[model samples]
Target: MWNYNFYIYITTNPTKTVLYVGVTNDLSRRIQEHTENKGNKNSFAGKYYCHNLIYYEHFNDINYAIEREKEIKKWSRKKKNLLIESFNPDWRFLNNEINQE
Candidate 1:
């Protein structure tokens, strides 16, 4: 459904050194939350400041999205980097584009 899509997304720190894998239905809001939560020790993404959107895959089902997210999280950095490069060759920051028309 266009109104509510599930997604498995990847976010990295400004330096692009740390990566965080997550699943969400509202991508724009989630990115905003991550940005607001940056540097909060209680959260992994926050603790590592991994709030810059780098890659994302859309899915119609939440279960499928979560499964993909879990699978990606178990992958090695090298593999994850390869995946991101496949979708985003330059690993560009995608945060600003999430809610854009």
Candidate 2:
């Protein structure tokens, strides 16, 4: 059987002012798309320039990934920030550090 990977990820603006929660199988490409979409007001991520990845969770199933994404999306910013801090204490931008293999 073929193996697949899915991710529930959180991204923020350069100033760390906003968070965008999403799920994707192709994380690097999706982040690139968000970066490309920056400043376009039609989309929330674009309007807020939320392309800097800060946190992520891996899942083997798309349904679970989507569920987790929805759960995170529902979180208050304060709760989300605490979650991110638990995973990423400094809230460092993690765009280039993962999925390189």
Best by TM-score: 1
TM-score of each prediction: 0.94, 0.93
After superposition, which runs of candidate 2 have C-alpha atoms over 4 Å from their true positions?
none
Across residues 64-100, which tens digit of lDDT does each residue of candidate 1 receive?
Answer: 8989999999999999999999999999999989968
**How close to the true structure is residue 69 of candidate 1, measured as C-alpha lDDT?**
92
Candidate 1 residue 75 C-alpha distance from true site, Å: 0.6
- The local lDDT score (0 to 100) that residue 90 gets in candidate 2 is 100
The per-residue C-alpha lDDT of model 2 at residue 89 equals 99
**Could you give candidate 2's per-residue lDDT for residues 1-101 as a string of tens digits?**
66789999999999999899999998998988998999999999999999999999999989999999999899999999999999999999898886474
Question: Which residue pairs of candidate 1 clash?
Answer: none
lDDT of 2 at 14: 95
